[model samples]
Target: MNWQELGKQVADYAPLLGGVLGGPSGAAFGTILASKFGTKETPNDIAAAIQADPNAALKLKEVESNNETKLQELYLKDKQNARLSHKDSRMPAALSIALTLFVVLVVYLLFFAPVPDASKDVLFMLLGVVVKEWSNAMQYWYGTTRSSSDKTKLIAARN
Candidate 1:
């Protein structure tokens, strides 16, 4: 019934909950909230851990409901905050010009990279592929760390 045990329980059920929610967000939020605010034990486990008082049960239910509401609110707030803070092209015209120039430069490089060779195009394409793969790997790493850290913090909070 301690936070550590409760956290393990949450982690155990997270995959199932993630499937139900169709995303990792739901499972991560549920696990964190349950561990942070809800009783140390799951709803079913609560009754036996503490005295089965009607008032306590009612309070527990209230807390669970509020936790869910708060979780949704937090999620929405975070989304809104991210949307608001996300890059709003300060100079769209300039950005477009820069992008066009970059594309032209790439084309120029592919056609003529100091050395007249078909391998230039192949090397450019390989470089682009490598950059794309690296970007994807970084994004995946960030998302995973964020979710894992969130769960870790909630678990640590219990101790």
Candidate 2:
């Protein structure tokens, strides 16, 4: 049997394993299960065993419960860390102050300042661009960016 073929089988099973577990991290369940239970057998052997054992799915589902609990715990810990870090950082406070000042300036320019209509229009357009750019930057930083290594793995798996 081809080594890669066996790997492909496991890869194919990963999503199913994930589905049984039911979570964002379910895709990782296959790797964890393989590590825990896979010893000498190839993926084919494991599949055959699972087919033969009537209680295999049940057992795997039981493991999924444990995995889901651990995943949830990790998520909570990460969220708590994020909150604490946000509180400790000065950037958020600085940004808030700067945005408040900008709002005040915009209100003044629009309502109280004897600015020309043309200048006000220009300022509004410029502010719109700035806001869009800032939103894009924030999304880029906070979004889930796929790394080159992940792409490489995907391409290699395909082959």
Candidate 3:
């Protein structure tokens, strides 16, 4: 079965694992699922197990909850790696700045400019995408509350 199909099925039970299954690291996450579920390391096997067992969803949730700490560590590590990799590169910051400027321009145009009826729909769609991406860019640059909390926990533990 395709990753998307498996992800959809698993998402109903384990949202986090489902997301991982649907992402770029689906195969790796599938291996984890397989080990936990005692299935073959394949989406098809995992999907079948989830479908066959009535308690599979509960089990999946339990598994995710139990491994939440490890998952958070992995997530934080990935973000740290990304930040380190981009430390010397200006592209990420430049992109964020550009996106900020574009969002401002789009909002200004929408509020003040006389947009043509035919182009308004396209512009609105573009605006939606740009705004969403701008939020993501800001989050990447500033870090999210979850990340901040994790940092606090780390510091507390270190002390």
Which candidate achieves the best lDDT against the true structure?
3
* Runs with alpha carbons beyond 4 Å of true place in candidate 3: 1-9, 19-29, 82-159
Q: Sorted by lDDT, highest first, which candidate order results?
A: 3, 2, 1
- Backbone clash pairs for candidate 3 read none
lDDT of 1 by residue, 117-144 (tens): 7677676786586556555544534667
Question: What's the best-to-worst order under TM-score?
Answer: 3, 2, 1
Sliding window of 10 residues with minimal summed lDDT for model 3: 70-79
Q: Which stretch of 10 consecutive residues in model 2 shows the poorest summed lDDT? A: 15-24
What is the alpha-carbon lDDT of model 3 when measured against the actual structure?
Answer: 0.79
Model 2 lDDT on a 0 to 1 scale: 0.54
lDDT for 144 in candidate 2 is 42
Q: Rate the local accuracy (lDDT) of all candidates.
A: 0.48, 0.54, 0.79
Model 3 Cα shift for residue 153 (angstroms): 22
**Model 1 whole-model lDDT (C-alpha atoms):** 0.48
Candidate 2: stretches off by over 4 Å: 1-66, 113-159
CA displacement after TM-score superposition, residue 116 of candidate 1 (Å)? 5.2
- Local error of candidate 2 at 78, Å? 0.4
